[model samples]
Target: MSLSSKVRTLKELPLYLPRRFSAAQRQRNRRNAARPPAQGIVVGLLAQVCGRLVKAGEEALRIPERLPPSAQRVQEELKSRGYPHRVVETEETTRSAEEAARAVGCGVGQIVKSLVFRGRDSGRPILILASGANRVDVAKIGKLAGEPVEKPDAKFVREHTGFAIGGVPPVGHPERLQTYIDEDLMRYGEVWAAGGTPNHVFRLAPNELADMTGGKVAVTK
Candidate 1:
């Protein structure tokens, strides 16, 4: 191990490279480090969108939680029957079919105009759940009831149905009346019904309403 031998061995060794990236490679690394990964960015955006959607849904649910007592009862009744539709209360009145359509932003045919009629012979109430756009023929409804039908006054309506003329529903009557359904009402996929008050209404599918009311669908012509 002489000094000259050590010097010759060191001179035969390979040259050393610096422990640093080139200028171009260093610039590329800096660019990559400056921004988040594509996958992480996408996942963060998706999380934000999902959070917004959940918040919107919660707000919608809360908006309908302020229904009036009468409307609340209707809401409860519908939920009890497995219909989870919300009761929407409007500032405008929905007493008439036209008014209801305008207030609900739906067609007149989409409103369920509940009517109470007196059976001339049996003296029992005959409920006709007709389409708002329909003019129910008393003769046709009478034929369905098997007795002459007369439009009952508001007093009779309240006494029999436990609701006012503008807020009558197929159910929630003092006594279950024989109800006839207007076939035209079944045409609409969805219909708006009074929720125990004129200003309160609820969206209901025609089939579900028919089932809930236990009424026979027939042509009211």
Candidate 2:
């Protein structure tokens, strides 16, 4: 795809990436483009370069020809909820925050790292949509949740969310949990979340994410 079209495929990403962050990347690309042949990087292609945000998500990301069962279910849920961005897959699994961010070509902070913790006493699931850049402090989460919370295992995650860890989207759980969003994630205009598989992800506005999950904004430790 041409560069602009490649960017377009990411939908709202180009417009919603942090302005200061995008500007800095463009400046660097301009400087790199002016370097002489001795620099060994091709000036023509380099000149067209934007930020990693421009090239990364579309280049590294893939649109699966066929969706798996879990992926298909997540797709249906997103459609049912009117989420504009659809799932994009990757050649490699985005099992970690770093991997997802790099694959999506956005800041690590823009990735919604979905986490599941069970109430220590209630035996209920609690979902935390934290920024990839911040670690959710379990103790603080417990305080915010008004109950002590502890991490759930893979089995619990699948049973509760209807998907495996690393691939759980912010919504589509069989049961609605008490959900919370990281204030840090709310700082951004757009954010990416898991698409029901380690290799899948999708983007959405933070507020819309909150609504979809019926989540409250919080510091998320």
Candidate 3:
């Protein structure tokens, strides 16, 4: 099975099992659990990547407890990186850049959307970070890639990134996928992105994020 398939199977197994936990089961789970909650490994890994790239320390801000759906994990990862973050609790869901901007009171251009596409070569996934105000120019992307760039469906996105489409982060694929960052994001000194989970988010400079992800800087949209 593909890596995406395996992760899907693992994520789905819980649905077939009971929700209640026995003492032994809980104990076993605790023994294997990692700190700061392992449910958001992708978010955690994003922070690790940021740490490696920034070297001088980066800011990772967490959202409030009652904040949107995908910024929670982002908050944790940001805190881990020593970034000063404010948690703004709101009713808006951060599923899109517009919504995230509204919830955080930022400009639409400042919302960084992590996008995933099926690479033209090897058929593996590639990640793109684009400004909220723009749409991806696929032909341009194809030329840069030297291969055709195709949009993957919802199932394909979840399978490859281990996160739903609306909550895709720049880092933390089951495998390291090729990443491209939009040049437009450079306009803002700081921008926000999903934290791996729907209820979390984090902010960073675009150049800093590019460095952290080792992402190619391009006009993605």
Candidate 4:
């Protein structure tokens, strides 16, 4: 009989003479018949694993390293004034002068504390950039401001400077402030100042600080 006539279906596909076929040849034919299904399963599993890996990589790439809005404002202000330094965020809080010094790895005196005071009579905002190691004499500040000065509440600081009390930067206030710089800060070559948040800061030369804020240097100890 013809080969096509004998093997009408896939199940019947075998050597033409089954009685003459060796045991090894029959076993090999069975294995070959099973191969397509097994190969398909392995290929499908590999495709799933590869697809999962690709999805994981795409998710990781979507993460961003953008700065906070407050910090970005400070950076823009610095850039506008042709300032060379960039603002940096620290893991530790730089809310206080001592804390800022610790966070920046500098001496307490190298920290510039931006203190906001209100003119008692004019109701205007006065900014004092004092050294961390020094305390502001209200009477001295009042003399420079041409009016009695008093420390204002947090609300006043935020309204006038557009920043919280602890994070007030020397520049970037909503309005131009009558500013005074502590003469003592002139002793340091480089000083740290609050950027725009409690954990943010920037470094600049003491003279650059004076030139940037246009604040008159005087005795504020």
- Specify the highest-TM-score model's number: 2
Candidate 4 deviant stretches above 4 angstroms: 1-64
> Per-residue error at 166 for model 3, in Å?
1.5
What's the best-to-worst order under TM-score? 2, 4, 1, 3
Please, what are the lDDT tens digits per residue for candidate 3 over residues 15-65? 111133345654444344212211111211111111112211111222233
Question: Candidate 4 lDDT, tens digit per residue, 1-221?
Answer: 33244334323222111122244643443343221111000000000010111111221111114567887898899989988666655556766644544443334444566777788899898888776556667788888888887767778888888887667777888888787787877875555566777766666677887888889999976
After TM-score superposition, the amount by which residue 152's alpha carbon in candidate 1 deviates from its true location, in angstroms, is: 1.2
Supply candidate 3's per-residue lDDT for 2: 38
**What does candidate 2's lDDT look like per residue over 104-162, in tens digits?**
44445445567778889998988877655566677888898889887777788779878
State candidate 4's TM-score: 0.68
Error of 4 at 221 (Å): 1.5
Cα distance off (Å), candidate 2, residue 158: 0.7
For candidate 3, the per-residue lDDT at 50 reads 12
| Pick by TM-score: 3 or 4, better one | 4
lDDT of 2: 0.62
Better TM-score candidate (1, 4): 4
Q: What is the C-alpha local distance difference test score of each model?
A: 0.56, 0.62, 0.52, 0.59
My TM-score estimates for the predictions, one after another, are 0.67, 0.74, 0.60, 0.68
